[model samples]
Target chain A: METMQPALKNGRNVWDSVNMPKEEFEARIERVRTAMAGRGLDLLLVYTTGLTDCGDTAYLTNFVIRLTRGTLVAIPRKGEVVTFFEGSSRGLPSLKQTLTVGDLVAAGDLPKESAAYLKETKVNVGTVGLAGLKRMPFQQYRTLTSALEGCTFKDADDMLADFRICKSVRESDQVRRAARIVGKLTMFLKETTFEGASQRAIEAALYRQARFEGAEDFRMLLAKPGREGCSVGPADYVPMADGEKVIFYLGVEFERYWAEAIRTFTFKAGSFVEETSPGIISGFQQLCAAMKPGVAISAFCKKASAVMAGKGHQALAPFGLGGGIGLGLSEKPLLTEETPGELKEGMTFALRMTAESGDNYAMVGNTVLVGKDGGIILNVEPARPAE
Target chain B: MSDPNLKLEKTLELINKKGLDGLIIYSGGTCSILGPSYLTYFCEARPLGPRNCAVVTKDGRVSLLVEPVWDAPRMAAKAWITDVRGTSRFTDDLLEIVKGYGVNGTMGLVGGREMSEEVYAAISGKVKLEPTDAIVETLAREKSARELEIIYRASRIADLGFEAFVGCARPGMREYDLTAEMEYVMRAEGADDIFILISSGSHNYEMHEPTDRRLKKGDIIIGEITPVCEGQFVQLCRTMTLGEPAPVVYEKYRMLLHAFAESLAQIRPGVEASAMSKAMNQVISDAGYAKYCYPPYMRARGHGFGIGSIAPGGVIDDNTKAAFERLQAVVVHPNQYIPETGYLACGETVLVGINGIQRLAATETKLYVKEV
Candidate 1:
């Protein structure tokens, strides 16, 4: 594989490097400050663990901790932002390198350091907003809470989630690059016949091809049409049979941005087994088509169920309809029954549809962007066999 | 089915022979237990959340104790071991299971190092808590043919990652950026879990986390790349020198290679693990670089690699006393620092056979020179 060159700013792509420039970042912080003032939030503590929930932290500060430890980004209603990361004296250089000179605190003494810094800086702490603290350990939460004594802790995950739902120009470019790679690999897999090959061999071939396509990270789950359950990875060595339907959920990461696409294939060219059945496909399409800027998420979910039922397939319950995707594989603004509000433009979601036919099951999903006209498919490819 | 049963029976017999009433396999979510990944060897699935354990008795009955009521059914189905029970609190549930077994006379805790203070106190009150790394280590050391196949595949993936790193790591790029690219490549290669520790500098002071420090001309980028496949661990540590390396750096690299050679030379069926560490230490010590052998300087010379047998015999160093056994996989990284050339990584994972040790990975041990 050859090295991937940094992307250049151009109108050829949906996004460019300019989306994440220092000026845009400063503007985003300003927007956060305005939102905080509106919500009466004096301070906002955004926590991220590993690569999973680091988008918020990375948005504010370009640093992403590689370890499985928590990193926090503290943004007061008015002041300089500060970051806390776990490490020893060895972390000093890294802190200096990744963070701005004025925006760093040793993670070992984070609570004390944050308190001292906040007090010295004289930032008001009345109503503190927190995002991504659901998985945060209690000790860390307690420390932050205790440090800001009179502040009322409120879940501002929605505030952060709202900001994350919309993809900036740079993020869209990265996702588009990742999507192109995934699309190329999916097409390659379709051409590569699987007869006499084990699942492991086929998976390995796909992985190798993805790397060749310049995907930074690739993950795939292969399920035979009539298989019992979703057995991801290359562990199962089931040999490919002529009539078996193969489904692949493929994801690729480019420059730390992730995009995913799901496709199904059959061995025979004309034999279109309901590899991810069309009934499920129609349901997903209806949901995707209905996703507009002003439509409530709950209403969209209801429409999804009605579409599934109308197609004579068991309506997939709320859990599988997918949600936002960015730095992490899955993000908020989830399409669940309890989801708070409306769909917005620039937001991305994976519209998933799964159905069971007797013993056989099939699923088809695609990442989509909410456009003014309708949801646009990020990974565009023919669903049927090539003539 | 019968093979696993027979193996369990033989293990139980060995337990009887060793005069231990029961073996307590303790695993918790921490750096010591290395998180839930190690539990996959016995349970066939990674444990979720805090402390959970599977205790097998001399009489052949097994019980799995876990926290949180919701995880019980999932653990039971995934582990393929019925008699799965759980507790809201780990300490009380652990005590109940031990008392129920009636073999609480002398218990051997597999991962005693990571047991919580509350759980340890509860168990020690009723049963004698003996710290024996043998229970899990012995089970993990001998990989079944099926397990070996997974490790072999994982090693191949690691090689692919190294190739990816070689292509992507360049001057004017930040360490974290390279790390992100490498991880993204590995994920694309279908790697489920990756533990990559890397460093880059003109002189790599120590091998630690990735930083945003931009690589300069003639910098050395060292990486200890490990990928987890089917819950098995396979690793390769290599150093890449950007542009032409200085004479001193090359000499230090040669010394590290020599130290690794001395360690590899000591591997055999009957050789003690400590002997191999001693041999390697002597090579560095004789070269007047002995002070970097232990703690305040270096953590470990080498360590055993597998699903759950990370520290059974302890990390290979001059103080190690574990004996080499057939099919025991170990990685020897004489990854040390020299005042002249920062940190040099020279290591390979090898499997001990009857006659000698065989390298698991096919990557070359020599320093890779990446042209800027």
Candidate 2:
């Protein structure tokens, strides 16, 4: 759940044509243009920071900033799509490697440069749609709003979100690849002797292996559930004591798609054994059985809550039940009690379950595919119930 | 949370001096090695969630509001402030705290660039905002004894990371895999975070995120290895050769060594920060590549680092206004580009002390050539 720590982006970063080709982005832009026409928006300005919120921009243009800066993809009603990022012009050689958009401009200030583009292209008088405007830095937002005097602004976050909720064939493949990389990460953990090793030793080795397996980005949060304090990221690098139960929440983003999974393990003897609870498994399986293409997300959330309650598992408010995953860690059609949306086929969502395991809390979940036939659990075989 | 009282005491003094009702040290969950979290400077708690802020009013009342709710317990243990709460309802809770204090006239805002439209609007409805990044900058311009220790430790981690780069990098290894090995060594050395950029090829343009591009025998692997320890980010820019033998590569890297040394010679407690860059640029210019010293080829010759103030700021080019001050932690690099070698990295972090400059890392800045 602690997914917001700033990423170093120290892993594999590329725009693989085989995985997500330029044709995909071209189709995405065409669809966005059609959507803009429906909404009477002459230009759609998609915005996202370089952090976990870079889905909208990455969805439209395969470009993602490695640094903590702002990026805007301006898709006009027609003409070549332009990408603006907050950086120096020198970054083009590196940025152009991943950016599918043709017209890339590096600016000291994205808002100021975007405003200049708006005037240069005579877009100030046109109705513009802003996606992910709320997430933009206030300084940039202020600059953008103040610079464009005659522009009409409309919120297109939902429109862009609607487009991203359902993954295409290529997008689903990316997620599957991401999930497979996650499998390698967990496999490395099981194979290595990290049970009694220091936390940093295990984390460093695990991350190294994950990158070798082609992880673009990685995040992990270990829950020493019965420990003294929250102990975020194991600051002291405490050695894992024998027979200690811990939940390892790993989110691996391969290419641009994210595949998040939570696994529970108990260190016994000299090896780590899976301790995923039976209740958590049965509860998620029931939800999978209930899922269909047209099922409402609210109903899914309701079922999840009821099913977990029956299994003696409590929904911890801090770590959410789970949400849709694809381009973003959590995208539209999020699983929440009040989320108003319907699940569609090809939409991927990760479901998480938390249950008290004796003296400690254990968690387990997997990336599930909202299939045309039924819900498909993407990865993570449920381990045997702990004695 | 070492010397939290010192920071709080300084902040309170500034509040009194500026006649402000209170001060808010905020973190938008955007922590960079260059510009770290200001909230961490004030309270020593690196915020894991977005919109983590601490309110320090004039009456000595302090409250820490963190998002994600789960991070609150960890923050509580890390922060000296006892009033730490994991915030669920963001804007409402923040406004409530501001309103409850009856001190909503003019509040100093740190980490203001991180604020979003909603947060700025919600806070602006109540108080006037004063850009107060300087408050923390002033507090951090001079390092404490503990800060120097952390800076050195972080620098040592950077050294180890680069050593890993030297050991793990070889022919057929992907760029990402090389970085991962480096990150592993740094993390084992207690680095809380790491930022690494790598470029490998015959003619490298710039260092970006690690890619699947494989390193070849003659590839020049350039890496900007930064390992952050307790938010004290130390960067080491290095250029390595998979196998020796390009005369131009050796010549260009040696020129960079001269530029870096000249830059180091220009550091003092009273000189302009731009002077170091100018001195470095002059050496490059004397080498007959003056045109490449500016943008599109070169970035900041150096930058400052700390959890709080990254003073002497981003680019220490011809226009940087900040001056070199005593005990200021800064990274001096002569990372440059030439048509011959594409680009080469050479630099190390240092402490500008009262006596002279203190090099933090034990690794010497030079071209490290790994025999194939």
The best candidate in terms of TM-score = 2
lDDT of 2 by residue, A1-387 (tens): 556465467778888988788888998899889989999999888888857878888888888887778888888897778888888898787778888765888988789988898779776667888887777878889889888777789988788878888889889888988887777777777766764677767777777877888887888877765434333443347788898777777888888889988788888775678876666777778888877878788887888778877866666544567888998887766678898878789989887877753465667778888888768887753254678
The reply for model 2, stretches above 4 Å from the true place, is A224-236, A277-279, A355-361, A380-387
Query: Please, what are the lDDT tens digits per residue for candidate 1 over residues A70-124?
Result: 6777898767887777544444553455453237666555556666677777774
For model 2, residues B1-372, the per-residue Cα lDDT tens digits are 577787788889988898888888888886776575688778876787878899889878899999877788878988899999888887788878888888857899888888888788887777788888878887876678878788888888888998899998889988888888998899888888889988999988888888888899999989899988777888899999999949989888989999999899888888889999999999999999899998878878899887778878876887787888888888998888888888888998888977568888798788999999
What RMSD does model 2 have? 2.7
Model 1 reproduces a share of the real contacts of: 0.00
Q: TM-score, chain A, per candidate?
A: 0.76, 0.91
Report every candidate's CA lDDT. Answer: 0.67, 0.82
- Name the Cα RMSD for model 1: 8.3
Backbone clash count for every predicted candidate, in the order shown: 6, 0
Candidate 2: residue pairs that collide: none
